[model samples]
Target chain A: MSERRFPWEAVLAFIFGAALGLAYAWVLAPVQVIDSAPEALRAEFKDQYRAAIAASYAANGNLTRAQSRLALLNDADAYQSLSAQAQQLLAAGQTRESQQVAQLASALQGLAPTVAPSTPTVPIAATSTQAQDPNAAATSTPIETETPLPFYTATARPTHTLIPTPGKPFELGTQENVCDESIGEGLLQITVQLTSRRQLPGIELILSWSGGEEHFFTGLKPELGNGYADFNMTSGVFYTLRAAEGGAVVPALTAPVCPAANGGTFFGGIRIVLQRP
Target chain B: MKRWVWILPALVIGTALGLLYGWVVDPIEFTDLTPETLRADYRADYILMVAEAYQSEKDADLAARRLAIFGSDSPAEIAASALPFGRENGFSASEISALETLVAALRAWQPASGAAP
Candidate 1:
């Protein structure tokens, strides 16, 4: 008579081989694709493509073509995508890009006419405050001086009457999430731009969350961009972003989950973009 | 036959299944698609958008640089390639005109093909 032996060793070998093969196939030698449609792009890359399309529309002032390009993203609602991106770029502190996306979205909605709207007169109040704050502005202001010192403001220009427009609302244009562990918890990166896409330096950004409110100004890091400022956040707090200039309230901002560089995940950082929409 | 012989066959079968699962049934997704692989209609619209931008910016050198993303094709050739597509697909005369304008600039343009920035 013969006795049957269990095949436990063979079963163990099969499991080990399967794991090894899967690791090799999926991790070591995955397929390499050189081409893909913009519609099929990963989320972050799709954001970049939307920005380029917005920029191209800005340069061309062609609504039809802009719409056509937006279609390539295959968004169910191109306007919603543009509007969403406008906020994201703003929250990311990309003032120029945020304005471009906002303008493109506006144009698509027919609110911003594709016809180059005659340049709105610069808010005289906004201009004077920006011009006086910089030492380079001294050269622009042009007084008889032998040497201009860095960070020096010329005192002679009489302050102009604060126009009614300075009192105008800034209207929150966009707010976006940025999840990077490098940006410490509850960080808010803010940038403001004019309708013309020029960064609006010196305007104040006010943050009010739950029981507390704080304020800051752009141009704190002019090297970063004209309208740039940052704030550290505390965990578990909800925040609202507002303009000290009477308008533009972005409510309900909180940190979203973001992946860490070291294979961990954390939740923090909100970027808000504000402009005279 | 020895029990060890059965082990080798089982291991081989397991590996084959695993490789099939990873390579075919659940392959990694493609995320960063370059511009060259766009569908034909999308490609034409992109060129037309470039041409529209050219109309306003009037920067032939810049337009040439943008078209260069397609690789291995002269900017002029790329613009020209889109015209037939534009016409067949009911592109308006003005839209077609923008494409033509781009082609003209690209044709005469050079490293001193002499289109102004």
Candidate 2:
């Protein structure tokens, strides 16, 4: 055999080709695929965009910034869509939340005219006399009617006001007595009587015992008067009474002693007076 | 024939090296993902972030809208789906509980028919 010849060039070519292939396969190809793959759902992106707008609105209370962010959705009918959502929420009986959504929709609607029109200058009347003249008002009726009619109609619908209901204030010098008495042998009756004797329709009393609670609202028993309410307590059990409004506890009279069962009849009938604090 | 014999070994070695680099040494990670993936654990973290944002903003509608993107039919379902993932991912107990409360609020806001049973 002739002196052995080494194919160094072929070996080098093979190494180079292998490195290129590896780089292409490992680094380039997968990166391209990842870059092309859909990252998030359209709905998800919309939600995120809305969240960002809300956050910006909250941070600065800036309607302009919020509207600018909302415009990113590129939906010309975004306000209408929000309004529809609000209506749907209302139909679902989510009144509070529906009102909130409706407000956002209205805000977006308010921003539309300011954002869309390129003309920055407002039209000025030729003379102040035109604004004051009755003849001018009569002549401009058509234009005025055209523009303000929609504004009036839009404002006519009462926006739901989320005012917190105030707690009923007790009249000064008002006093009430809650008494428990034995009606007959082994029977007891509890009664509430007001010194002013004004029967407030909404005042409520809640009585809690060992494992139960009962509510006594005024006017539930018309005979009890507006401020008058009562509940019979089970003998041999301790109970606490509290005045309440819409589930909120208010200051009320507490029984001085827990009613006790006496072999045949109940004992410990006590009367306590509640005064306006 | 003898000169061409080197071709087979070179081809084999080159292919082996390429595969080694591609699969082991410099392999690409297709699984590396952005927040857009919305994976279970990622979604749990996102919901927590939204909740924190809501606490300061106090915007219920915005919160509900953000949550709806998860594609759950109801907030209860979303809570149910996220609770385990959140727990597994080491989310705080308070965060998990707040999510439950949020679910209840959202459920209350949902229509009776749309609410989770």
Candidate 3:
């Protein structure tokens, strides 16, 4: 019998090819993605930093805690960014939110003195200074009484102190009685009407339920005629609507039991009418 | 040993051929993608999606859980770090803005301990 020769040459060839191939693939011919650092990305980081500060403020309601959390970024850009956001909010007529954001921005500025303060359209610094002065009580009186709602009777309409514009105030006629009615199968549509049967416009209202509150301006839908708004409520859920600007509470309206209608609409709802007393 | 001398030639010839193929010929070009790079690309999108979900669902616990995929750090930290990484990786201005908005929303939504959802 002839002795079988070992195929060592083939084995060696295979190993050599594999090794070379792997080396070339891994070291020489491999594709690479060039990494880049963008200025916009830096801006984004700054934005996130501000957002984080705002969120911390919202959660803890502690300026110190939020400031401590902001210390991690160690970037002074937070001041400029947050100051800009506050300005934007103020321009949009969100006074309360703008003040809150401005406070956060001021906190960031305190943390980083190296950063120059950005100019705010609103008198943030002046307002803050006035707030801190013990003897400025007379000047601060208007701010303390700037409630969104004030009491009004049928014979006398409350002055609109919370109007965003300086000269234009809301012309609130009077409080009318709300009519309890159901429409569109089981859907509850709360229609705010005047004694003249015209739909009320530009009235801010708050709807409060078990665990949540929603604020909305009326007259959003022209077809709904300025006074029509709808809310989804569970049967037996008690909800209250209050005039955000006048502080008058609509009689507590409970979701009424309604026969099952098309599209799962709930019926037996109440209609609210605000009339002059 | 003499008969096996062919192995030397074979090895040299095969290695030369493989090197030629890999270097100048039809070489396999593998993309050098690391986990960090992948995360850099997807991080902004992920944060925005999480924020939208949080807005609709208002579930902070779930947002925290989903945001944990980036790391063990707080969602704010992860988002803060990701802003730079995402920008370096070519995230658009709108995308970055969206991410920023979401981070803020998430921070605002974080409930106190034992608070109701």
Which has the better lDDT: candidate 1, or candidate 2?
1
Off by over 4 Å in 1: A1-5, A16-24, A27-29, A39-52, A55-68, A71-102, A108-111, A116-277, B2-9, B30-43, B71-73, B80-97, B113-117
Instruction: Name the runs in model 3 displaced over 4 angstroms.
Output: A1-11, A15-277, B1-9, B12-39, B55-58, B85-94, B105-117
Task: State residue A142's C-alpha deviation in candidate 2, in Å.
Answer: 66
**Tens digit of per-residue lDDT, candidate 1, span B11-100:** 988888888888889988765666676555556656776675676556678677667767778999998989997777555555577688
Better of 1 and 3 by TM-score: 1
TM-score of model 3 (CA atoms): 0.26
DockQ of each: 0.20, 0.09, 0.10
- Ranked candidates, highest lDDT first: 1, 3, 2
TM-score of each: 0.45, 0.31, 0.26
What is the Cα-based TM-score of model 2? 0.31
lDDT of 3 by residue, A1-277 (tens): 9687888767777687767765865577553433311111344443443453454353223344345334433445655555565555544665444444555664443321111122221112221200011111123321122222211112221211222221122233343222234343224455555445655433456789889787754444436665555665556767777755453466456766544436453446554555322
Worst 10 residues of 3 chain A by lDDT: A127-136
Compare candidates 2 and 3 on DockQ and give the better one.
3
TM-score of chain B of each: 0.71, 0.55, 0.49
Cα-based lDDT for every prediction: 0.64, 0.44, 0.46
Q: What CAPRI class is candidate 3?
A: incorrect
Where does the lowest 10-residue lDDT sum fall in candidate 2 chain A? A145-154
